[model samples]
Target: MMLHAGSWRELDTELYSLTDNNTHVSIVVPYTAPDTVFEAVQSDSIRARVDLLLLETPNMWQLNDLSLACNFPLTMTECYPNGTVTALAVKVESVRNLNPKYLTLSDRSCKPVFSNDRFAFFSFNLNSCGTTRTFFDNVMVYENEIAMHHSMGKHQSRKGLINPDYRHTVSCYYLVNDTETMAFRTRPRNSDPKADPGVGQLVVQMRLAQEVSYDLFYQTEDYPVVKYLQQPLYFEVELMRSTDPRIALVLENCWATLHEDRTTLPSWDLIVDRCENLDDRYIVFYPVVADARVHIPAHVKRFSVKMFTFTTDETVLKEQIFVHCDADLCDTTKPDGICSGQCASPLRNAKPLKPTGSRRGIAADISQHRLSSGPIILSDSSNFV
Candidate 1:
């Protein structure tokens, strides 16, 4: 049958067999019959197409079978941190009657590392294999798709049966673990920050206090709502995958602006020179503490600022605020190092201190990484009513 204008119409008649039992009745039909209807469906990621067969009854409709569909199992075989990269392994069920040699990932040449008659296995770094990374609700998502391409052979050609190209795809999703490092880089001074390949990342977020003693702080929404001049906004900056016990995180400077463009006019300083801005009396810094709730390496820094808006000529510009911070990683084992300094007055013509020790035996130059969070909307207290 075919559907037309919200109604089903009988397209043609076909031969069928029926069986009746005391418990149930079954009807069997040939899938290769001329009257068989197959509906094309786009897979969840819209990266693949599937053909579905439907069977209709008196009161309901049911999917008959996915025999002609490309719906195959995609499983994560392994996911673990491997030094500078996250090692990942995935397996896909090979399409029946399709050569496994033609089955590969989005990068057409990325063939399966291992394969049998039924399943094809792939292994690579998470950053490889044509994986695309995106951020959703503060969580990093990594996605990779596998595809199978097949064309009918000349020997199988038949009248009215075209040898059309057949393409099937299935996608696999992986979330970045907290201990895994993301490939991100800090922007040059006075430029916009962006994600780049082959660099460590620092995650900065605005959080809400859940318990006393800073034991439990939950990340707020990407664009958090706040009350203007009535509440304080808390923030945290963390270095990803800081598994070494000797490493420490430091925030060298932090500021807020009315726009995502950091260089926009009318920026406000909350912290400068590793100290709270002297002009912002309401700014508060929370000491980094290690406990069951927080990670052991102490790669996190926290602070809070009372909500306020940028004002000019006594006119308040109640725009969403974007907070940005320059951070660095230091070796806490080094005595009197960059991380051990106390908040003091900003010095004139003073050079910024670099981290003193190595990480994982690699003596690479540690630079200040910049991270930003927000678009924090400050609503008037009266607006709540």
Candidate 2:
């Protein structure tokens, strides 16, 4: 007899009764197994629910116990201005049976730079590793796709096929550094016997704080990454000079732009004329203070802004944002110091500083320069809460 469970079975029985000389056995079976069908449907629904849960919480799955043991953290070590090349480094686990012999950056083999019992390091040049370069407005971006190939010696066996390889990609942006040559003012046709003192060299550096405390920062990573509309970004801009103690750093204006060119259209003002932008309620300008451990000078300026992106009617440009600041070195000791401690608004008519030759004191000799920092990438909002 055929059973509803998709199997055939036979059963026999003997009657041992005086009244029952002959007996017959009858088997009954249902057309379908209702329990089995219900179980299959329930299992499919459970699988669908699990898939939906994974989709909703993607990061949770990444941190699950079944995740791979290795991690890949790619970082840009240095960017050569002259050659337009960038150096990148990556760290990976150094498991005994899962050790990788070498890494491939865009198909170019890169030997391990350093190795230890716990981790192995790999370094490569973006330009020489078959990297692809693209231009976004005035910014130049380089992308390198890297892969790790495990050592074939241990993986030669058929069981080795079970192990998985690792792959990751990172993009590096090229931006002008803080060091800039001073554009000295020209001597006037009619000037005093004492020639005008040339504006000395001034170096400006911008850094991003790693936490809300605004103390620890990613000083090495020139290209910092931030989350979208999740956390506030703290920035510290410092002016370095050794020529004169009377000189003070003044940030005239600061703004954010989608492109590398600060003059590009669709820019958002962070600080205008030494004052925070009134339109952005999330902007907070921290008082300038000295921190010797972080190399922050006593005349440093710091500010924090909530993460944001540039939007337009056509489309929302969320690739990368750059921060640019127009700063000047002012002689504070002068009687008529050009560095007005207040904002330049309609109510306050602050006179512009005259040319170095026209003004008598060094206060008028303003060394104005534009400093930039970024290619700051905003993480996808879906990645976070």
Candidate 3:
């Protein structure tokens, strides 16, 4: 058993292990240092909902019993059999002061020993072997309405990291109340009587980092897939939400290049006009086509759509979305395929075509192909219908 301040400690298991062999283990405190500072208050009684998960070992030749408690007269059950974890929400109220002699130990053969002087302590009910080591994680201690103490890991780095600007439009909606100002930071010590809102900040950072380097994003919550060369797609860039609806956002670099052509370095062009501006998030009714050049290709293509956003006169954000083009994922029937070069002929070469379908009076040159759909009328019913 280890004595951190004035109380004994027992640490087990490796939670947040950084390496495959749990060699690079580090612990990040959820909250700040205690208000009492480094003073060892043996009488600082606490009430905790301890969650002790005991992982089973492959060797089952011998079975041992392990138990854990903060107070001498621990409000917990004795050692349970092997291959099972213990979860107890003990209500350890104000107990008397404890010292080195107050240290609680097992009178049995395998006496508990102290390894480190961290916050919480751990015990094992296993036969000592090269791989048989106790692992404890998520040891949360609460008192009254505040989360008093939590367990930390071994050989932890005491380095301070700069808080990253995890301000993505998508995650910012849930992280910050106002995007333009980025206000309302979450605090764990608040008097809200709820779990730390600081977790939401981590969630926002994780989401931004995860999507930025891992997966692609799109304006629509649901991204579509198109059949390559057989279909056409209309992709766009839009804001998730806006703090001010009056401020205009100009989008640029609506460009794409096939995955296969990424190495060969294909030419890139704007998917939409540079002057197009978005006043609101819901201004998407007609989709903006991705074909920047008049001559588009027909092939099963996997490409990315990258865009830049400018608020007022300054560039604010730049993002990209990944997509694949194939017939299997085509969402529309009238997909403008790649440039065939045969249909570019002059319309004067064809004779004046007469309307033969139910819809008449629609005369056009056959060479200039187009598509239109409506309720068809009978030849004699045009007068009434």
Candidate 4:
């Protein structure tokens, strides 16, 4: 059940290792009832066919109706509302763009591999209020043996990842008015598609100004029953343009507090490290800014961002990262967006600038004192200019 992707040679090697004699394997995509979906896929009696399952929501089952397609849709339906698992008797065609093409029923033994940009997962936890959804932002082998097997949260307790002690909170922008007040100016304009910069043009421009932020939770529980401590998290902030449905480039900046001893902050050593480390119950604040000209498509429901985090262990740490505007109008105490911390002095007009050397790595000259804790001064004329 473990799935992987690569060139033909690499895939051949993997298949050889799993089943020495590479047989003519037919790939099947199944949906509905995750348990029964796996049962049909793992049956050894079904020779000559390798079963794949695409997990889907109940509301979207119509996509699995492959009775009319010429060939199996990109996905194969496993279990229907009835006891039928795989509707092989009826002609089932694969639907292109549907995901999770494979499933391994054996928990420890069968692992699933997925292709890039093909699939993503949503971990749903239902509470009294409603269902809160947490999305794992990628389609890859997420190493969560404990949770997968024991139904116990393991990723949250892992050591080197984001530990259990982080405060998790999200800030939102909502339009609050008197209960009886009527909102908005006019109905959306309708225009001909043939016209230039039609109604779609203005709609897209305004949507780009708003940015969204969300809190990440590794494990889900009822809102009232949860307790949180402070820790670091790997943040993946992406700008979703209205023109495109995909999540665009991910932000690279990250921030965390000093270690438990206040000696030094944790550093990322991997080729690409996303998680930050911090003390339990500690507070780390970082700012978020939007360019205001992000170039979005016409139709946008909510300009919201989705933040997700997972540890290799089972500890839950609550975290809060405040996002604000880059303008100088924010309060001095929580300057989430301002460029000049809380300086009240009238700003001097500086010329357009670029870094020349190593300083290029850290180019925001928001301070004249020192770049970091380093002793490099702005004007080393020893005496004040």
In model 2, which range of ten residues has the least summed lDDT? 46-55
lDDT of 3 by residue, 1-385 (tens): 1112233233322422122344432322211112111212222233222222223355423232232333222322223335222111211222212111112222122222432222322243323211123223532211111112111123333232212221101000011132375568766875556664553110000011112222333232332322222112333222223232222222212322333222222222322222111221211223223253211122111222222211123332122223211111111232342211111112122221111112112121111111111111112222332
TM-score of each: 0.39, 0.39, 0.16, 0.15
Q: Rank by lDDT, highest first.
A: 1, 2, 4, 3
Q: Regarding TM-score, does 1 or 4 come out ahead? A: 1
User: What global local distance difference test value does model 4 have?
Assistant: 0.23
Point out the worst 10-residue segment of candidate 1 by lDDT.
354-363
63-110 per-residue lDDT for model 1 (tens digits): 453433223232334445461222222222222244444456667667
Task: Give Cα distance to truth, residue 279, candidate 2, Å.
Answer: 1.6
What TM-score number comes out for model 4?
0.15
Model 2 clashing residue pairs (backbone): none
- The count of backbone overlaps in candidate 1 is 0
In model 2, what is the error at residue 332, expressed in angstroms? 0.3
On TM-score, the stronger of 3 and 4 is: 3
Question: Which candidate, 2 or 3, has the higher TM-score?
Answer: 2
